[model samples]
Target: MIKDKYTYINREISWLQFNARVLQEAEDESVPLIERLRFLGIFSNNLDEFFKVRYATIKRIEEAGKAARSELGGYAASELLEIITQIVIKQQSESLDILNKIHEKLEDENIYIVKEDQIDESQHSFIKNYFIQHVSPALVTIVLSDQVDLPTLKDSAAYLACNMKLLDGKCQYALIEISRTMDRFVVLPKKDNIDYIIMLDDLLRYCLHDIFSIFEYQDITAHMIKITRDGELDFDSDLSKSFIEKISDSVKHRQIGEPIRFVYDKTIDEETLRYFMDKMSIETNDSVIPGGRYHNRRDYMDFPSLGRTDLLYDKISPLPVKGLSLERSIFSTIANKDYLVYTPFHTFSYIVKFLREAALDPKVKSIKITIYRLAQISHVASSLINAAKNGKKVTVAIELQARFDEQANIDYAEQMVSEGINLLFGVRGLKVHSKMCVIEREEEDSIVRYGFISTGNFNESTAKVYTDFTLLTADQRILKDINKVFNFFETNYKIFRYKHIITSPHYTKSRFFKMIDNEIENVKKGKPAFIKIKLNSISSYMMIDKLYEASRAGVKIQMIIRGLCCLVPGVRGMSENIEIISIIDKFLEHTRMLIFCNNDDPKVFISSADWMTRNIENRVEVTCPIYDNDIKQELMDIFEICWNDNVKARILDETQSNIYKKNDLPKVHSQFDTYDYYLKKLQS
Candidate 1:
């Protein structure tokens, strides 16, 4: 239970709880064995990023001598830092236990994850040959000494710290960086129909003598250590450099950013640990977590399948949208009515098809879209280039500061510029986070507009795993508003009024508040009033307060939040009418949808904005109203499917205990049921 003094959960604490839910998936017996290992990878990866970004921010706040109590959800900056460290240590220990259990289970299935010490004579030749051919060339080793200052470690990169006692009683220290390019899991030749896998770390450990063959040392030992540096990009006021150049420079500087978290193998010698800590100047108050034998467990995300389909989740074929054909003229069909494309269930080809159609269509004159993060080899970028080659005036407003994707976006931006496509770097202050597209086609003596607005990125790779809604429509009202957004991108000084869609940096907060107020008034008038919301996260206290006010006014609110939520629900006389659950399943729950009971008429919206502070007041985001009756109902149906999920959904409350939602109702695995729901729609 929350203390009576506070009305909200700390966002950082809530985020840790969310990661705990992910860890729970790894612990779940029902989850497939290999997939459970992958969940451990995800958990480790999430914690690494949390330390790099969120925890680093709090450290900065504390260093700047600011209490930041309200900003940190009522906890002092120093207090929150200590709390986060304790929670992370506990989680790291739990993850290591889970990893051990998974290894045992894998062994049960005849898949032995062999250690360096367990290498047999038959495997010896293969390991030696593999290291010489593959690992030897890419291996980067640094010799550490008192005379030379230790080089700054790359952020989140794992290293094997070496301590060697020489024959003369003197010691030599060295560091060996784990290569990111090589595969972390090396599959050995199978025998007796049994599979064998060795981790790159253990492989290095086995080859340590070879790595240090030149050193005349009596005894040598290596332990894994990793450093997570602050990830915030800092730009200098250089008047001559372009935005892309500045971002590129800042990204390079991030390699040596202030260290926030230092994770080392618990069994490392005290002398070695102390020497490195003194060299790196890591303060005592900084987050120094003692972990298991291996660091950078994020590599387990790519744990070799080894043809073990039985040990992994069954892969489902992506279904096609009922009436939408990839070969047909998407423009012709969507021009008449809006069609909703929910990804992972519905194929993402519809999005590529829309762009491909716009590229080849002779009548199309211009195309405008917002680009955030694109796939490594994006077909979306190729299609946009093809459109530009066809003489269609293509304007792309790609965000350069999309957080960790700055370099990828910069590369694509330069390529687009060379192709003669007009590019907008977005508004000077705001990040253009809206995912939308508009195409103007000269048809029947009047220009007709067709477009799509999505709650996720236009990247096809993420589209396969992230559940997002894309409304493909030729609704002139909505398209006109989309055009205004592009215009805002080019000329940001003038804020345009959007009649059909709510936009951020100026209108989202107030507009959402007005809608919540309407719900409050409706409940007072004895009209059907409720609010159903699905989002990746909600940290905006302003938005949470509005919901709390509506709840106090007797409005029923059901929320499906996939990540951190600050609002403390189920509190009497405060938020008793509010209930929230987080669903973490096979596909990431990323669709941001809102359904307001506007006197039973219902107002539905699909948005590129979450209820986070940045999405509301800092970034350029869009919340496009769902006007098509069928599409709106389809979204509502999916929301209900997720809300009714009893298997993966975790109830959110003051206690931060991620208890799975269960009941006597028939079992509903929402992710699977959602796929089935679409399949049945096609059958119907």
Candidate 2:
């Protein structure tokens, strides 16, 4: 157990601070204008998910009358909910201010984002025609009343709460659902080199007359309001339904789940707000946030570029990995030596190439892979289907519970099943979070195995923007362990021992603890001892305590966590030897890596798991040790580059201030520098 004096930050509160860093990117004038707007959208989207998942979870605990102090890092569930609401309110207000400033900047660049009243003659005809032809058919308008039962509002759907004052003393209230199928941003015809854009909310306000023409109202008003429902899937006890059917039913039921968050425009009139609140049965304890004019500002992520490339960050071409050729046979190459592919810096086509080769090679008799998420247009899925058609035994273990991507995974699973590919839903009560593929081939009168392990999903779309690593090898030892994992998926009753890779829920914590103990022993023996790690988040108390123990033993520790770091770094006698930083930049820092100095002979690993309890104890994750000396050096070099980043890196200290790492040395933008590093290696 971690001592109370160790000082752990609440995960929810730390996540809010991470979003605050996103808001900082939006407010940063040094960033490109259009990219800054997208950052604002990203900030809003992150908050929406936080409420739906984290905040909803806490609300459930409060309703259950559980303090949950220990689970929540010492704060009671009710207390944490109040703190989250207050922090979110401040963030929302700051985001609105940032949006206003961005709008002013856009105006300076001859890009005017106009309101309903700002529509001029040049855009008037276009708006009317566009609405009649495109939006009118898609619109869902409900005329609400007290006499009739209110319809259950769609979760997270933006609605214009319409208040109409009739000629008589009575009033009519209606809600117009914004058509999600249509573009949230509508661009108007340019006039004299000046570009004009308007949000869909303003467009709806302008067309209110056309919508409610029969109401005979003297005046009408519309303000945006949105509700976020609890997103946790509650399974049914139906025995007859298949696993897929149960999951599908749960996803459908999510729409009517209890409300956890309600956001509305502060400018909205009191009568309308109260009426809707009462009708929706919103309680005072619910997260009722007063927001800006727009509710779903996440739509700003898709704000049209308008062909102004100058106003956006310049796109960099993904580089080719050294010694890896997409045109060559990946199996033949990996048989010789293990190679690492770092994505976004390097093109993701190598992964696709590997799968395609496995599909066509006649000697390749079988393929096994674990998938968490796939791209919408997944070449990886197509390749697997192709392998199945070519008489290869292809077995896929696809996770259907990848949050927010569940429906997409379900659709892909059905398609794969139809194509004659064997699908496994993974072991009961354990999520298959590992990203790995193993294949067997007939080689010179004997069977040989080849495979790849990754720190991310094999999704091509995300691979373009998420920094991840994939290691390809033909090592028999590692491939044997990979095969054993697939067997466990098939027959989970028998727990198997793995000699090479670390598997979660059975071995990850113990293995890591042993490794840390080795480092501590080396420190005591007067040898160089240090630990370096990179992960998206770390919150497990046992893991944090182990690091504290190592720190107290005089072993230096450095961490680069992208989000949700709960351990209080730099606390004397607790984590005095520990320092942490987080990098928020163009590409998400998603790779999980660990390095330990065992008497100067370093041991390095890349994993799918973070230090969170779910990953360590509930999910089936894999941590693969880097055996190739070259790849080990490459990983260490990249970590050092990121550690020394003066730009985009924020020191994650006790204050949670998100201060940038700055020094007198020449600026090192790690993302750009890493790309250059790979480019130079390719040239060499």
Local distance difference test, per candidate? 0.93, 0.93
TM-score, every prediction: 0.99, 0.99
> Per-residue lDDT of 1-684 in model 1, one digit per residue for the tens?
322226888899999999999999999989999999988999999998899899999999999999678888878889999999999999999999999999999989999999999999999999999999999999999998889999889999999999999999998999999989999999999999989999898999999999999999999899999999999999999999988899999999999999999999999989999988998998777899999999999888889989889988888888988888887999988877889998988889999999999999999999999999999999999999999999999999999999999999999999999998999988887899999999999998999999999999998999988999999999999999999999988778898999999999899988999999999999999999999999999988889988889989999999999999999888898899999999998788899999998998989999999999999888999999998898888888999999999999999998889999999999999999999999999999
Q: How far is candidate 1 from the true structure (C-alpha RMSD, Å)?
A: 1.4
Name every residue pair that clashes in candidate 1: none
Worst lDDT 10-window in candidate 1: 1-10
**What ranges in model 2 sit over 4 Å off?**
1-6
